[model samples]
Target: MSTAAQDHPAAPSPGPRAALAVMAVLAELSFVGASMLAWAPLILLQAIFLGPTVAAVVGVAFVLGTWWVVQPPAPPAPVLLRREQAPALFAALDALRERLDAPPLHGVALVDELNAAARLSGGFLSLVGGRRTLLLGVPLLRLLGPQEALAVIAHELGHFSRHHGRLGHWIYIVRAKWDVYLDSDPAHDSGIDRLRRWIASAFLPRFIRLSMQRSRACEFEADALAARACDATSLVQSLARLELADALMRDGLRTRLHELQAASIRPPAAFWDLVADSLRDEPAARQAATLEAGSRRPARRNDSHPPLADRAGALGEPVAPPSWTDAPCAGESLLGPLWRGTFDGANARWAEQIAPAWRLRHLHLAALRAGPDPADTAIDPLQHTLQRLQADDEIAASEQSLAALRQHAQSQPDDAPAQYALGLALLARERPEGIEQVRVAIRLDRRFAVAGYGAILSQLELHGSEGELSEFTRRRALAAEKLESLDTGLWQHLLKEELAAPPPWARALLLEAIAEDRALDACWVLRTERSNDAGQRFTLNIFVARVCHDLMAADEVDEDLLAARYGSYLRTLFPHNELARVMLRFDTEVFHPPLLERFARLPGCEIRRPTRPINVDVVRIDSL
Candidate 1:
């Protein structure tokens, strides 16, 4: 345990806490009462108007739907740990449970996140003696000391205190789930659905506001109980150090992962080890000072946790320093002798899952170095940093890269990719000339227009003149408005226009693109409204077709595969800098045969037929 344990400090229970707690329980009860009998009145009306049979079917459907929606999500199967496996950990939990006068835990689980939570085991039934499953995050164990881990559990278990009762706990559980779960959609506009929408949009928001107030109050109570169960000092330290650990994971891990892609390497994911070691051994003075994670910021709208600074202040002067000892981490001590075996096994599987995405990035990096190709046209040069510039590793690499981009743009004055890439590079270096390049990029390629406008807004937000942000924000808003209108116009004409033949050049390109596919169907192209300001841009919605009589043979053409291949062929048919930005729409007809049957009727759409039919001599390969 910690070197010392102070007597329970004053836990703030502002008078609003009790009132709001009562409000949340009442809100939940009100909704539950309305929900249970919600369908009865509608069914009664249907029975009076139609008949018993029709009403019976509708009532049954309603009941089944309710059952489906209310069924609690199943716990993650992979990372579940039993008491048999982690006896010491379970023993510690048992002691904490008795100390706090809480119900026995239903289960223990682990997840990939850098946080911990306690969820009710059964959906609504948890209100009546159904225990909670305490979910421990892997990072919590790997990063914290033993006493700190105990403090984490103590706080989570404090929520299950006997006085808290099943009713309040269950209400909290359902309210949390209902935040995202609503049963209303355009397809189902029945009376019950209208009521569901009302609950979601109106009653739910008010209820959330009330429950959130209660939840914040409960946090104070939980913290007090945790301080009592596992020393106050340990609790304070965990709060501070956990925040620092979170900052490290969020800021550093993504960039580190991206860097590994250069070598196509798959190292064992010892991510928690790196964080733990950093904390245990002082790495940087800057990081040591960053103990608070938005601690001064107020609680967010939906989050139950108050700001860390506020939470620490409420508990009295903090005790934890943003540092760790050379002692074994909480995972080693808490899980007893079985810790490494379990952790290493799980870590290996995580590494395996990381392989595909890691290698994909490697391939992407290689392609960038090799230069852009026909099939790689969709690969925006602006998305990637200058790989060649970084390779030189010279003091003047940034300037050299900018100079190279300038020369390329000068040589190909009309090219969009060169302009866009130059714009992106300049913006990275905080140059004003970037804006001009982006504007020219938008002119040459309408595809980059909205995104270019967004980039301009971002730069302005960072370093604009006093009134420039407001002016440019308005400009962005108008650009977004125009984009929406343009998209609407494109779709409207696409659906209603009569079938027409495509340009000769487009037909030949389509034929060349899909020559290998034996799906033996038809390809059609329809030219639509809205090109670049220079009138050089053309966005064609290409429709590829294959008619099938039986839905059972749906695997004849995989919709996903068709979308990926056909979409690529059309999108990157030519280099982005060479010609117009061509955005193609692949057919959902690959899956929806109904849409395929009616596909030909679209205005200005026509199938590309080969010009020459030659005599063919066929021979059976088996005979040879």
Candidate 2:
């Protein structure tokens, strides 16, 4: 939340226009405050008058407010590059920080992605002088020169410039907080919960759009700082390359990367070179690409980023990325040996995690490509698509798709994807029967409900059937509430407030189930119930602790296997079939694992705790 005014010395005070911007932000925050006011008093009053249970909810909410509870964020496939580890890289970074007069970095971590970002760690505490970390992507470093990289770094640092008003700072802070707040448990059925959610859903998204509209100058300010710190040429070139590489990665590299893994095919040793080849469009094409780079779209979502075209124009020219880079990149010059270590280790770790998905794809691909049987009704839609894609046969692909979906729907009417796809296929052919299948899909699974309902609603809207659409839209909104439950403060409050104990039948059922699995340590049952426009929502998050020597190295239990072993029986135990969900998850890393830890600390949260041969030095129940 550090602003330009705080970070930049000798910065001018806000003019009338800037004051109006600050007032606008203050107004947005007031709306949030009003929403909070609706429930916060109730929460406090309940804690004081109701019982200790409500107090627990209040404590969790307060902790969430400070945003300091989720400790030690788990960076995926992280290779922590300390100053000691990469002195040269750190020195360069330090020099850049000094030149920008930015705050001292707490650390730098390298990850395998296509971007670099300046991230404030320790959440809200970071707002009041917390640690800041810079994440450098290997692909980003691999593509740019050191000077260019610094320009990128300077631009990121510019986001923290203190020249802006305090309310402008909240545009970043509260917006990030709002994203997590959105993950609140949808199952919280209280009137207060419903009202709070109504305000958030109806208002916050639009408020975010308005806030972003007001704060675009911050992005321009960041760009200006970058141009001043480095030559405009370096800044411009870096921007162009970053945008191009990102576009290429999103357009095709992701699918290719997955396909290569599935086929056990090693990508080119010079992977960035392969990326560069796809970017080698003619000058005319490049100019067209410039206009379309994350182009100015409607501020419909919470995104605050200005379009690349706008940013480039603000920097005094349009961005035209080069076709090739022959020079030694930032990775070669700045980090040297540090870059070499990441490729084999980081990617290997990533591949290991996704091995199960890869194996499934490999099986399907190998079977179909090696002369698929004519009666192979079990053939995956993706496998068929991949095979036909080679021939560039759109007609064959569409025919195969509809056929595959029809077969799947007939074979397994309960399957959500089959039902959903079949509905889509029918709708594409202008059949009204499609909506029925979509409705069935929505009923079969909440996962399909949101999109399925959307498909139906779109058709209803096109037909000008507002009467039917209104009722259907309500159902879709309810499904949306169910879909979004994790990473929410309200959800955490629900875990503390409502889900203190499992029913006797559920407890006994869970006990009998986990008794047979030797690897299962204990299971924590957290359920949340909410009532709103969605009617009633119920969510069961079962965090299973495994008895193991090394937590990371422990074999992952197949969720379907565990569910098959226990799910049907558990379903039978449910008191009612009111949009209830049971999510069987391992106590793995997540956005707010501390919320789970809070659940564990709750009295009677564990369904059954038994003696396990756990290495005391390693896995701890408290860690959950």
Candidate 3:
């Protein structure tokens, strides 16, 4: 059978070690075979064809083979923890499980840093064995409140309840053993002999990593469980806050590295590289310094997770995070003014296109700073920073920004930009009066870009029935056609309005237009939002874009499309997805790597595998 494990390249260090081990066993077997063969006429005849040097060569190869087997074994290092100090943690998890009617937890232990993981083995209890303890990091325990911590535990429970842990672990073990038993055979002596031996040993861990990357559904289910165990509000807030902090920390690290690179007394490049390598090698340092893949970026912000804003909206809760700009300052900066000036220039570029009312808002802040007192200046930075934070998708921070804007706008009630900003905040919350508020703002200033854009998008979102969808489609097509002929500034301004749209269909159409103009990056961003998997509409948008634009497809599409396209020949090569029935109705081609894999497994899918990572093709279909 075709297997992914058989195809993977091995880890350099471990592969060589396994290769050596197999060589040792093979060398001993070879010696016995040679001894036996020396008495055989066939082997003796072959030996006679070679010079006396052949014996020396064979003996040298056997000696080298023995050395390979003597190499050290590379097992995963386990982090140990004590029980006595972490009793309260277990008590919390126990309480949570009881409330959720989940099975009793086996044990809880403290890890050194900020992380937690659950291991499940086959038994009456999901968690068992010395290795099965849920390792909670001390920093994380302190970082999250009770409800948030409960949510984390619930996520682990999600793993258990869904049988992900059991199924995944079994797959891991089987794949690992399969590699060791079957792939790393010492018999192959072709040009790819070294590469094959490496792949034979490393197939499992890499596969496990890939599986983990695709575990978003499990993560979301766990988040749902956490919401049930505690509350959605707390979990959303906790995740948002933790992700914000993680982002700032990573930014700090990047800033420090950047500074070092710019310094006059910078260390030799080789020395710095060596230091980085040394840090990576040290277990303790690596544990403390290295961020998990999760902590590296906000989950929803990355390609792997659904869009952060979309996920937050789906949960129907506000995710309030402390803005980095509004964060408390700790140290003096020698180049503070330079950074401030840089920021001013950046804001100025946007200021030119921002509505006049927005310009007035900035002018007002600048005027406040111009007052005699330095305290006024101190407040000005916070005011401007708060306004920036308000523009971002933070509800609580936006409210605080709105208050500042309202205070200024009270003296200038006709300020359309401030009113538009306020409208955005209300619309973000899906407040009852949000539409009226946008209308009020637009009445005062019809040229207000955000207000106009938000109004249209909100209308599309609320009234996508009867004739709205048709009107929207007509308007979008006409707009796309005209964008090329419009002035650069006008086109850019309209495009910004399109980008600001909150509705998925409108955004999809906007991205499609941009992609038609070869704006690949914008297409990628819009395509990322199709991870929701709501219905046929979402699929149609994504599927058409996959053909006409470049973007990554979701797991369901990747897994299902192959069989639906070519399942006739390879009846066995079908992915068992729940959505297969619905997905099969759509016209599909094995255009992407994932889709290609699925299609290749099919007996008769016609598309050939692409040399590049991304592939694109659109198949026409009359129905969903």
| Top-TM-score candidate index | 1
Q: Is candidate 1 or candidate 3 better by lDDT?
A: 1
The best candidate by lDDT is 1
Weakest ten-residue segment in model 2 by summed lDDT? 1-10
Query: What's the number of clashes in each of the models?
Result: 9, 20, 3
Q: What tens digits encode model 3's per-residue C-alpha lDDT throughout 208-304?
A: 3444443444455555656666666666655654554454333333333323322322222332222223332435423333223233323321132
Model 3 lDDT on a 0 to 1 scale: 0.39
Error of 2 at 14 (Å): 2.1
For TM-score, candidate 2 versus 3, the one ahead is 2
Rank candidates, lDDT, best first.
1, 2, 3
Tell me the tens digit of each residue's lDDT in model 2 across 1-624.
113212333343357446545544554454455445545666778778988797777856864563333223434434466677777887877776677777766778887777887665443424354456778887777778878888887887765544342345545555564443343555654664565566666656665666666567666777777676665667767877776676556434554554564456333355654565555542547545543634633333444567776776766655665535567778877777766776555556555444434443344344445554555443455534434332221123356656766776788777665566678666654467889988787677665676677788766643425356556777777767754544244544643566645554345445554544554555566555554444445454444443332332455545564444344434333322223344443433222356555756776557656354333333223322
TM-score of each: 0.60, 0.58, 0.30
TM-score of model 1 (CA atoms): 0.60
Tell me the spans in candidate 1 whose CA falls farther than 4 Å from its real position.
Answer: 1-42, 46-80, 123-125, 162-169, 173-206, 278-284, 319-321, 370-624
Model 1's alpha-carbon lDDT is 0.59
The digit string of per-residue lDDT tens for model 1 on 262-293 reads 65545447756766765555455645455532
**lDDT values for all models:** 0.59, 0.57, 0.39
By TM-score, highest first, what's the ranking?
1, 2, 3
